[model samples]
Target: MSGRQAVPSVRGKPGWLRRLDPLTKGIWLLCTGLAVMLTLSLTAQLLWYLVVLILAGTGAGWRLKQWRLFALWAMGFGLPLLLFQWLMLPVGGDEPLWQPFGSGGPALTASALELSAALTLRSMTLFASSIVYATTTEPRDVVVALTQQLRMPDKLAYAAAVALRFVPLLLAEAEQIRRAERLRRLTPVRGVGGRLQSARRMALAIVRSALRHVQDVSTAMEAKRFGSARARTHWRRVAISPAGWLFAAASIGAAAATLVYF
Candidate 1:
């Protein structure tokens, strides 16, 4: 055998949505979130969420399995919140849909139900948009966009990039620590108090690991003279494609229309 490493094959072609610039996607996410927040009409909320669902589906290459996962997540997150909103909203007027206690007690009305549905849709729209941005945009691209396009300080941009890079690592490290503890056949903790104690142990271990990782990163950055200068050059450029600009314009326009019309 030759001393060569095999390159991994690329999967399916990246969709148009993924090809768009990270800044464009960020704009879309912001517009969608703002629209969700500004609109109280159920119809407007539904339309905004539908647009986000379409974008997410396109980004995922319209895979049925991915759509199923999105639906499952939407239902899981929205249903409980919807129920709680419907129960707690002090919306008066309209006929009571159902009175859990007595007639004199708090009652669910049509307006309350409508408002709850709108609120649930708003939450789901924001959640789905956030997932799209997080999954499609690379951390390095975010740093480039911030420093080069937005004219942000290199120190702040690099700090944001480091946070994005470290969060997943920290989570994986915590999982590994749990697995190592299990492999050692540690005493099984039971009951609420035992669970709290286990969590405390895990938290301490994670904190120590995080501190070590931070120190190593800081040392490396210092050796490289990172943030020593006011200006920096990137190895690669992140340019905004025509399609990305068009997408951003359309998203902003739709958000404006939704705000004004509904």
Candidate 2:
């Protein structure tokens, strides 16, 4: 099979990043997420916001396709932050409006409420940024970067990449099955029982679909000489550019400064 054109890879650009290595982008996102969470000053949070701006401007914002997904995550992480701000901060001070609930006889001030609002925004922003990372990155790219650059074993890395590739495919298939189930007159749930029944159907569909896709992918990979130690070549290789290192260094430096200060 000398010079046989290999099966086209689902790697490289996703019609979005235009050949931007997913691994590079993933590391940058990781750094940004860590920095945002640790940053006490909202100004610092805003600075990292520029990274997201650049990503969007470059058309890589296709990862942000699932903005609605962020709402659920925002509730999970941001709600707690809001609750933290509410319980810890007093609602009154010089401009006291009401009294603290128990123990301390301090007045709850408007300033404390204002602080909560800011904290809420910070939490939501952090969560939203995280969603962008998960949505944008294709797992195979990450595995390649780790294996090729970090000297990790290709066998292990490829295993990880294959696993990631199946997640979204399974999700899509499960969604399809759910619709099919609905068409079978088992959907459009109105009561608690109906909802529970729908959930059960969806869960079963996901499991079955995932198993089938796994088998298909495994067979296809095996047929294609994947996991071979015969030195397969990449037609489209991931190259680390000078820009990548610069981005990484700046992210690390910025994150470090924030942690030390705030």
Candidate 3:
């Protein structure tokens, strides 16, 4: 099975974020992400991350449990990247701070730590922005906003939505495969080489399964005459309100100011 499932849906009562237009939310996320990418200071990225966290917590009502899994996943990758940066990216004139494996190993230095922190914090900022947008916005709303507000083709918007919706189903199918293997006592090899072979087999199985599912979905969509019409009508409409525009603009402006001045 894949180590993790896909995107999460909102639970319980809907919040204010649900009422806002998906396009506006998307713009806010994009602007912040760009600003975070351009900024060089760790402190600036940290501050932007805090702002995003607050919005996610207060407006989105994101609980600790929902975030815990994602945080662990982020740390799993981010920590290694951080270590790599610290060990390999330092300049020649950097002062040695500590040597983990005595004089034989590369010395940890202040410059390395600063560079690593900056890079990691920027990545974390982008992650937070994405999570907030994904958790709060519905796929249907996004499709509607894309088709109506952005002038996107109906075929493309709905296709993207279907692909996203397929993610969880694929994850579940992979998990089921793993469980069935375990039930049949089909243990793979014990050595590293054997593990790689086992992983390759599992991956191939998953790809085949996904291809089958995609074919089924494509057939179903074709049967429904999905793209026959020049224009499609939506059951729901999403339009940006005055408040949503104001909020998006403010968020983007704040990020730009911080990027330039901070």
Give each model's whole-structure lDDT.
0.76, 0.60, 0.76
Which residue pairs in model 3 clash with each other? none
* lDDT tens per residue, model 1, 213-247: 99998999999998778678789799999989998
What are the per-residue Cα lDDT tens digits for candidate 2 across 1-262? Answer: 1111111113223545434566665676677778777655656665666556556445434423233333444576677777567667855545667665654665556677567756676665564454444445567666767677776777777776776565445545654665577678843679988788888978887887778878887899889877777454544457767776676677678678878876
Report the alpha-carbon TM-score of model 2 versus the true structure. Answer: 0.59
Residue pairs with clashing backbones, model 2? 91-108, 91-109, 92-108, 92-109, 93-109
TM-score ranking from best to worst?
A: 3, 1, 2
Provide the lowest-lDDT 10-residue window in model 3: 1-10
Q: List runs of model 2 lying over 4 Å from the truth.
A: 1-18, 36-58, 63-140, 177-187, 224-231
Assess the local accuracy of residue 179 in candidate 1 as a C-alpha lDDT between 0 and 100.
64
Query: Per-residue CA lDDT of candidate 3, range 52-125, in tens?
Result: 87887678765554566557657876898889888887546777898888988888988778878889878887
| Model 2 clashes, total count | 5
* True-vs-predicted CA distance for residue 243, candidate 3, Å: 2.7
Error of 1 at 225 (Å): 4.0
